[model samples]
Every structure is written in C-alpha cells, then in structure tokens.
Target chain A: MNAFIVIAVCIVFVYTVGFALSLWKQKNKIGAMAVLFLAVIALVLPYFSYFQS
Target chain B: MKQNEGKIGIRDYMAIILLTLGSKVSDDTPTLLYKTAKNSAWISMLGIALLSLIPILFLLKVFSVHRNKNLHEINLHLFGKVMGNLISMGVLLLGFSSFVLDTSVYVDIIGSMYFTRTPTLALYILMLVVCGYGAKRGIESIGSAAWLTLFYLKATLFLALIFAFTKGNLKFIFPLWGPGTLEIAKTTGSKLSIFADFYFLGIIAPLVSSFKEFRKGTLWAFAIVVVEITAALIIFVILFDFTSIEVISYPFHETILYLSIGFLSNVESMFLPFWLVAAFIRFSFYLYLVVTLFGGIFKIKEFEYLVPVFIVIVLFLGIMPKNLTYTLPYLREMILGILSPLFFILPILMWGMAKLRGDFKREAEQSH
Candidate 1:
C-alpha cells in the first residue's frame, strides 16, 4: 500500500540523517550500526507486503 | 566549585522546564482530554492547571527548605536508609512504569499510523537503543538535546496549526461546555495524567542554578502549557466539533492529516519526524531519570549498569498491554487514582518533615 511506502521511505530517510548526525558527533559505532540494521529491515520489509489486506 | 561542575545555569533549568512540558504536550494529551471533558476539554486543562499548583507549591516549599539537596539526599536525611530506600524504590517504579507505557504507546502510534506492516517489537527495539544511547550521554547531553528538540517541536507544531487555520471552521466548536457538571469533573480528573510526571522536577531541582531562576523557569513552563492547551482547543473546535474528537485515539494527528496547503497534501508525514524526535527525547529523558533515581536511592556508584535491566523492564511493560483500548484507560485511571496523590502529597510531606526535624538548616549549614 501507499502507506507502507511512505512510512518506509520516511523512516529510512530520517534514520539515515540521524545516523549521519551521530557519526558527526563521533558516535561512529552507533551510527554505523543504526544504518546497517535499518538497511537490512528496509530490504526485508518489502517481502512481507503480500500479507497486507 | 567549577563553573560546569556544581549546578546547572538558568539556561539549563529553562531547558529542563521546556523539555518537561514539551514531553507531556504530545499527540496523546489532546485526545485524552477530549475523551474526558468532551467539548470543554480546554476548560478541564485550565482546571487541572489550577489544581496542579497545589503540588507545585508543595514542591517549591520543599525546595525552599532543602535549598540545594536533590530528592534522594533529602529522603535519606529524613527517613534514613531503609525507609528512604523503600520510598525511593517506589518513586522509581512509578517513573519507570510510566515511561515504559508512554514509549510503547508512542511506538504503537507510529507503527499503527505509518508502518502498519512492521512489527511493533521492531519499533520498540529501535526506540530503546536510541534512548539508551542518549541516556549514556548523561544529564547535560539530555538538557542540550532537549533545547534543540523543543525548538523543532514548537516550530513544526506552530506552522501546522497556522496552516490548518486557513481552512478553519468556527462552527465546529458549538456549545462549549458539554452535558453536565459531573461530566466536566470526570473529564478533568481523568486528564490529570498530563501533569502526573511533574514529580520528577523535585529530583532535578538541585541541578537548577538558583531558586529565583527555577521559579522563572516554572512560570515559563506553565505558559507553554497554556499555549499547548489553547492549540488543542483550537484544533478540536475547528476540526472535530466535539463528539468526533472524543472518539479518536489521536485527534491532533488527525487534525494535522486534514491540513493541506495547495499542491502539498498529507503534511502530517512531514510532522512525523519531529514527532518521533520529540517522543524519543521525552521517553529517553524519563528513562534516564528513572535510572538515576534508582542509583541514588540504592547508593549505586554507576547507574549506567542498570540501563539494560531498565530497558528489559520497559520492553516487558510496553508489550504487556494487549491493545490501545486497554492500555489508555488503564493509564488514565492509574494517573488519577495512584500517581496524582503521590505527585501532590509526597513533596508536601517531605517539606513538612524537613522543617519539623530542623534538617533543612543543618543541611544548609553543612553545604555552606
């Protein structure tokens, strides 16, 4: 659904920016981990879309 | 004492007030108020504000007596170790439980509204990790971050409300006071949850630079509440009339969704990031306070060690409520029946005890 796309994109975008800011603050480990974790979710989230009513 | 080491300055205290007030005036409050007071939710907010003064005055009296000591130290002084520790543990439990419930509700709102497909557990983990990171940074970081978050939150909310006003309907808010006096009382009592967490201010009081500045900060904080309540009133009157708002889980979010500016549609999405940031800051600050309170009470040297344990507790509490219907009503009742008394009564009792024992003078002399 359109709701799913909008949310996914928004979450990714916001988290990416937040992670970048964390990196700038020298929280590199946290920043890197956040991106990697969310990236994996972003990839996998689409597969579950078939279950949506 | 070193400049940064002793106590926080006026700016920091101001930041705390803003942060505290901002955290409470989120997506949840308006809906809760509407449900309780019907069309006169704004009136109930004003009533609650008046009622809240009883507690605030008590807290101020306590701080006036104790001067610079935090809540934990004062408790230890008054009740000694065992009873003080027990009371401190009670406060900790109340704070932590409330924070967990709040954070979960926030996550659920986001998940339900936006990411319907994503598991609630995923959202919970994400929020907890971020909260833990912020908590690890300590009070100073939280204060400064609060300053920034408050700025964005105010700006975005103001803009949204202003934009929504252009498409306004004055007719929606007819017959301001709803059915009867008992209904108004019930609604006002139910919405006391918004002010329940003001108890945390006692613990943070020592960090404030001066009583004069803290008083000024409290005034500013109250002004923010006025603004929040007015905005909610405006939105309710304009968008939902009265009956419809009472039924919605988050009437404010729904109001934002109805907002449109020419080519731009569904601007609530733009507001979502700000909402998330605000929620994270609020939840994390409360969690940090809970941990700090536990550490201080138990005489633990390093509070950071308890972060994981608290996180696990929050996770359990967050998931325990099966759905919003169950969770919200329970929260409302709990705040009014249990939390409100502690929030209002404890500070007064502490202040009285401190005065009666002459501990205040002794503590002041010792500190000097």
Candidate 2:
C-alpha cells in the first residue's frame, strides 16, 4: 500500500474510534457500533486489489 | 407574513431547488446529456422533464397525504418498520455515494480547471469543511443561504450563457438529431435520474411551511430548471457544436473561459465565486440529507452530529481515486444508472403502497 493510503486509513481509524467513544458516552451504543463497523469496512476497502482501480 | 419556526417558506424552498439541481448545468451533467443525445441533449432534457413528471407527481401525491412526514417517515408508515428501514438504507447508500462522487467531481473541476497548482486533497478538505459547517447549521440555514445567493448566481450564469449565445453560430445546431430518435429516447430514459433531486427533496418535504406552498414551489422550480438546463444545452451546442462539446469535460466552465465581456478577456474568474457558492449550498444540502437519512435509519435523534464523521468519510473516499477525471465520471454514471430506475420506480411504489393501504382515502375523509 502507498504511504499516503496507509496514513489515510490510520486517520480514519482514529476518527472512527474517537467517534464511537463519543457515541458510547452519549448512550448511543448502536450508532457507535454502526460507526465502528462502517469504519472498519471503509478502512479495509482500499486495500483490496479489485477496488484499487 | 409570519414565518414558521424551523420551516422554510416557498421562496426559500424554490431557491434550494434552483441551486441544488440547477447547478447541474455547470457540472459534467451536460456532458452526460451531450454524450448520448448529442446536439439533441436539450430535447432529451425536455424528455427527461416530461417523463419525470409521472414519478414526481406520484411522489407529490404521496407527500400530499403524508403532509407532515418526511420521506423516511413515510416509508416507515407505508411499508412497516423492516421494509421501510431497508428501503431507506438503500436510498441513503445511493445518496451518500452520489455525494462522495459528485463532490469529487467538483473538487476535480476546481483542481483541474481553475487552480492548476492547488493540491486536490487541500481543495477537497476546504470545500468539504465549508459545506460541513453549512450542513451542521441545518436546512433552514442552507435554504436561507441559497435564497440569499440565488439571484447573483443565476445572474452570473445568465450573463455567461447570453455571451455564449452571442458568440455561437445558429448553423451549428443543424443535424439536430445528432444520433437518432431511438438514441435520444434512450438517453431520456437513462438520464431520468437527472431529476432525482426532486425525489430526494422528499427528505425536506415537511420542512416547507405548507403542502400547498411546497407543491407550488416544487413545480415552479422544476419548470424553471428544465428550461434553464435545456436553454444551456442549446447554447452550448451552438457555441461548440456537437462534436467538440461531446468531448469537452466541463463546457460551462469552458464557455465562461471562452467568454469576454467587452475588454474583459478572462471572465471565468468572475463567474467562479458564484458557481462555488452554488456548489457549497448544493453539497451542504446533500450532506444534510445524507446524515438525516442515516440518523433516521439508526434511530438517532440528532443526526446533525453525524455530519463530521460523514465529512471525514467523504473527504477520504473522494480523494482515494488516482485519476479522478476518469474515475469519478465512471462511478457517477454507474450511480446515475442505478439511481435512474430507483428514482422512477420508488415514488410510484410508494404511491402504490399508500393506495393499497388507503392512506389517500383516509386523508380525504379527514380533510372533509
């Protein structure tokens, strides 16, 4: 993976974690979980060679 | 006249419509139309408007009964929880993807056409931040900003078209049916999603002050956008002719570049700010809709909170593709293709569901 892609994924991962924590604090567990799930998918999405195009 | 709190009046609603869909002319939308219908893109636009009427009218009928409910709520009411949420999820996925791809296109436009040296990521972030701020402020703010700037935006656009018309030749529009009758009809069918903005407008349907005003504003905006876009298509064909225009990526920007007002050789700079304002409002509205739908689906009351998360997601996704000029348009065309059928069918389906459940009849009985 390109260094920029790696950094982008890391930034996204951090934002997702922070966001999920905030949502969890606010008692919105569902929203938090949804965010984490989506974030993971989004993070992994770019790495797949099929999607690279 | 006292304005309702948290709701926009007819003029504001119309302004939102005008800015959101009307800005399509300046984007790759005309290119999409020109690709298939060629010089007859305007005819295909008219065909799109005519064909769109059925679904739009059906959507209106559906909204007329569910007066206070937005699209998601209406889906839940008509389709029950499981199915309604499922349908809304599908709509939201399409809507969000469109937002990401469309914003990339605009960012690419800015990067490629105007600011040649600016980094695409930098431009994308700046644009998304402004739009995110607007979206966080909510629809009333977006609508008001749109209404505030509608005049100047349209005026600059009008002047550009007027100048283009003057520079263009009437003879270029000859061989009017550039492809064939069948192709034009097909173009009309496939591009029907050009008016999908109206379907998306259901998210804010209840935000309008009254059903009467919403209906009036919607129809008025629809008529104006059709005429404006069609006239723009005709002028573009006259200016560049079909061959060159079909290949041109962003004709409106190119036209503005080609235009010179008296001694002013470069007028595209003057038009840029207005287009930028319209673009900001357009995405702000789209961002607002996407989060709103996302919130509704997840049972989150304050969907506004999702704005930042989405902004970040969109920014990252938007900048992912290596060659945006080729990639964004391809993704956009695919999205449009998927959305076209859904746009045409969903409203009719909603109306059908409402009819079966006798919601309209109940509305009539209640009204009487």
Candidate 3:
C-alpha cells in the first residue's frame, strides 16, 4: 500500500469516527452505522486492486 | 437588494443552470454526439432540445403546484413514504454515480490535458476539496459565485468558439445528416439525459425566490443551453470535421489549444482559469445536490456534513480505474443510457400523479 493512500484513508477514517460518534450520541444509530459502513467500503476499495497488482 | 433567507434569485438560478449544463459542451459530450451523428451532431442536439422540453415542461408544471416542496418532499407526498423513498434512493444512486463519473472525467481532463505531472489521486482530492468546501457553504454561496463569474466565463467561451469558427472549414458541415435522420433520432433519444440536470434542479426549486422565477429561469436557461451546445457542435465539426472530432476526447479544450489570439501563441492557458471556475461551481452544485438527496433519503437533517464523506468516496472511486480515458467514456455512456428513460418518464409520472390527486386544481382554487 502506498503511504499517501494510507494517510488519506486514515484522515477520512478520523472524520468518519467523529461524525459517527456524534450521530450515535443523537440516537441516530442507523445513520451512524451507514456512514461508517460507507466510509469503510470507500477506504477498502483501492486495496483490492493494490493487492492484485 | 433585500431578499428572502438563503434564497437565490432568477439570475443566480440561471447562472447555475448555464454553468452546470452549458459547460457540457467542453467535455466528452460533443464527442459522444459526433461519434454517432457525425457532421449532423448539431441536429441531434436540436432534436434532444425539443424532446427534452416535454419533461422540462412537465417538471415545471409539477413544481408550479408544489411550490414549496423540493423533489424528495414532492415524491413523498405524491407517492407515499415507502415508494417515494425507494424512487428517491434510486435517483440518488443514479445521480451519485453520474457525479462520480462526471467528476472523474473532468479530473481526467485536467490531469491528462493540463497537469501532466500531477497524480490522479492528488488532482481528484484537490478538486473535491474545493467543491466540498463550496458545498459546505451552501447553494446560496455557490449561486452567487456562479453569477459573479458567469459573464467572464461565457465571454471567454464565446471568444474561443468565435476564433475556432474563423479557423474552421465551413464545407465540413456538408452532408448535414452525417449518418441519417434515423441515426440522429436514435442519438437524440439515447442522449436525452444530456439535459437531465434540469431534473436535479428540482432539488432547489423551493430555494429559488419564487416558483415563477424558477420556471422562467429554467426555460430561459434551457433555451440558451440548447443553442450554445448546438452551435458548439456545428463549430467543432467545422473546425475538426467529424472524423477528427470523433476521436478527440475534449473538443472544447482542443479548440482552445488550437487557437491563438493575435500576438499570444497559446491561449488555452487564458481560458483555463475561467473553465476551472465553471468546473468548480458545477461540481459544487452537484455535491450539494447529492448530499442533499442523501440526507433526505437517510433521514439526516444536516446533510451538509456528509459532504466530506462523499468527497472521500468520490475521490477513491474516481482514481480506481487504471485507464480512465478508455474506461470513463464507456461508463458514462452506460449511465446516460440508463438515465435517459428515467429522466423522461419520471417528471411526466409525477405530473400524472399530481393531476390525479387534484394538486393543480387546488393551486388554481387557491389562486382564485
């Protein structure tokens, strides 16, 4: 994995975590989970092809 | 000028329409037309304009009754919660995919055409960050920025097109119906989604100062975009002819590169900033729409916060394709094919529902 991709994903993960926690505090569990799920998928997408190469 | 809270007036609304839809000519849009219609691409464009007017008028009629409701709200009211949310979600999926593909295309244009040294990921990130910030500021700011720069953007574009026309061979436009009338009609049908952004404008219908202004702005902007794009198609054919243009991915950019103004040898750099501004505003508006629709679907009130999430997703997905120049167009064609029927039928369906529900009759009664 490239360092830049890792750094970018980490930064996005941090933002996602903060947002999901806030949504969770507000009792919007589904929304929070959806956000995290989407973020994870987005983060993981590049790695599939990366490993293939 | 005193105005309603967070509302954009007719000029601002028109500016958004012109920039978002009008800028289509500068990208692979013309290439798509040229590939099928050949020298008669402009005719297909005109056919598209005429066909597009039906749905656009239907959409306006729908909004004329539901004056205060945006698209999602109107869908819910007309179709009830379960079905409406499903439709809106489908729309969101289509719109989101279009955004990702379109933005990737623009980023490819920037990366491949201009910044040959920059990595795709970096360019995608930078483009999305600027657009996300604009989206975060809200549509009012985006509209104002678009309106402010609208004149310069169109002026630079007009200058380039005029120069290209002068350098082009008028005879190349001969054999006006390049393939045939049937092919032109088919092209028009397949690409009717070129005007599909008009459907997305419903997302901001209530944000416009008045329904009348919204209707008027949409019509005026629609007419202007049709003429502008048709003229661009004809001129591009005249400039490069159909054979050369079919292969040239970004005709407008190529035209600018092929132009020189008197003393200046290269003028594409001059047009770059204006085009960049339009591109930024265009994507910013798209981001705002996607996030807005996402929020509406997911029951999230503050959808603006989702902008960053979407930006990250779009960036990653956009940079995924190893050979974007080849892959993006194929994907875009598929999206356009999918969106064309949806774009045509949805508004008319909504209007039929509205009619059956007596929404228009109620509006008439209220007016009386």
Please give, for residues B1-368, the per-residue lDDT of candidate 1 as tens digits. Answer: 11123456667666656666664555576766676677777777777777777777777766776667777877887778888878877887777766766786687777878788998767887898788777766667677777777777778887877776667677665566765667777766655546766677667777777877776777677677666766657666576677777677766677677888678897888888887877777777787788678657644435554555456446545765666666765675575566766776787788788788986687689879
Tens digits of per-residue lDDT, candidate 2, B226-247, equal: 9999999999999999999988
Best by DockQ: 3
Model 3 DockQ vs. reference: 0.49
Residue B217 lDDT in candidate 3:
98
Per-candidate clashes come to 1, 0, 0
TM-score of each: 0.80, 0.93, 0.96
Error of 3 at B172 (Å): 0.9
| Model 1: docking quality category | incorrect
For all candidates in order, the CA lDDT equals: 0.68, 0.88, 0.90
Please give the lDDT score at residue B26 for candidate 1.
56
Candidate 3 per-residue lDDT over residues B189-251, each given as its tens digit: 999999999999999999999999999999999999999999999899999988889999999
**DockQ of the candidate models in sequence:** 0.03, 0.25, 0.49
